[model samples]
Target: MANLKELRGRINSVKSTRKITQAMKMVAAAKLRRAQSQAEAARPYAERMARMLASLGQAVAGNPDAPKLLVGTGSDQVHLLVVVTADRGLAGPFNTNVGRHARNHIRKLEAAGKTVKILTVGRKGATYLKREFASRMAGEITFQGKKRVGFEDANAIAERLTGMLEAGEFDVCTLIYNRFRSVIAQIPSDQQLIPAELPEAAAETASGEAQAWYEYEPDEATILAQLLPKNLAIQIYRAILESAAGEHGARMNAMDNATRNAGDMINKLTLTYNRTRQANITRELIEIISGAEAL
Candidate 1:
């Protein structure tokens, strides 16, 4: 029932919106490619490092002088959750998924009467957590101003975590992030970092499966002491990479959907416009003929 002028304005507005959505979709697609590649490239190294750390952990399992990072602080009364998410959101449920997963974990911990603390790594996660866990939030970090994510960012986060641990801020620390599985699929994952959960391989290495005993130049304790902190930083870096890739993938898919929907809407609107215009023209012609007949 809209007049031609009103309908024309609506059509123009939609067209403008369509253009913006299309541009965003293209940008997301381009970014997704590079992000995906980086995520994929980092996976093997992170996995291998985890395996090696696990093997070493196994080797040192029986040693009384094992590194504190490996053995932990002997209590789970206090818990720290490091939740990572994208700094920006246009990405459907990407940030929401990560936030939800962290919230679930927090709820479970709280139910068990454990003290919960939060360290948010991105603005989205911080915003989400602030709604419910504001009191528990220990700190927030954002990469908004950075041109590119780097190891230094991860190191800074790790340093903060390590400093807190050394200061006896918390007992157990867990990291939550989205793991990029494929373009259409991302899995929310939770990993324990503090008290460093040695992978199965680490346990195997400790069992001495090899025929020859391995000797350490600086001693196992000393090596592990250094490796443990570095491993924590590496793990954080890997998680951030995974999250970044997943965010882009989600955004690309979301924008693609938006663009398609906008196109469909435009089509529907054009159809309506044509119908309205035709009706108006037919009405005008009939009025003219009636006037001629009256004359």
Candidate 2:
């Protein structure tokens, strides 16, 4: 229902949009490759670390001298939710899904009469929570211009969190982020960071695997004190890598869909433009024939 000129303009606009979306999709694909590789590579190491910590944690389970990071401050009354999101979006719900999950968790904690504190990583997550959780924000970390998320980035976050934990800012901490599953599937997950949740299997394995005479050289407690902090950094690093890969995968899918939709719109507009032009030409020809007949 638009004039030819208007239709032409609309079609051109869609074509331009299509071009942009196509470019974005290609860029996202390129980025996804590297990000995905990095994420996949980190998994084995992280899992191994988790297993090691699980074993060490079991050894110190009943010991009062165990690292506080492993034993916690003995209260779950106050919870800190560390929400991780991408710094940039265009990745559809890659960021929003995680944010929504975190929000739901916060609400659930509040409903249970537990105090909630928020420590957001990435600008998008912070912005998402700020609308409702501004008062509960303990701090925020943004890696706006970082080309790639590295262990250093995770270490920085770990250091701040460690400081906060030492300060008694919160009793328990949970990290929420998207876990990279596939190009089309980024699953949001929650991990308990502080007082590291030990698997029941860990206790069983530890007892069976240990020999009565097997003794830790530096002592199990001493090794745990050192490893617990490194494990936190490793876990955080893995989360960031998974989030990075997932963001690219989500963006690639979103842009591909956008490009296809734009192409469809352009085709529809072109069809309308042709029909309208034909109608106008036919009317002009009819007028000429009628004038000649009148003559």
**Ten residues in a row with the worst lDDT in model 2?**
205-214
Q: Global lDDT for candidate 2?
A: 0.89
* Cα misplacement distance, residue 246 of candidate 2 (Å): 0.5
Query: In model 2, where do residues sit more than 4 Å from their true spots?
Result: 202-214
Q: Which residue pairs overlap in candidate 1's backbone?
A: 54-201, 54-202, 55-201, 55-202, 58-202, 58-203, 58-206, 59-206
**Deviation in angstroms for 117 in model 1?**
0.7
Worst lDDT 10-window in candidate 1: 202-211
lDDT score of residue 37 within candidate 1: 81
Superpose all Cα atoms of candidate 2 onto the true structure and report the RMSD in Å to 1 decimal.
2.1
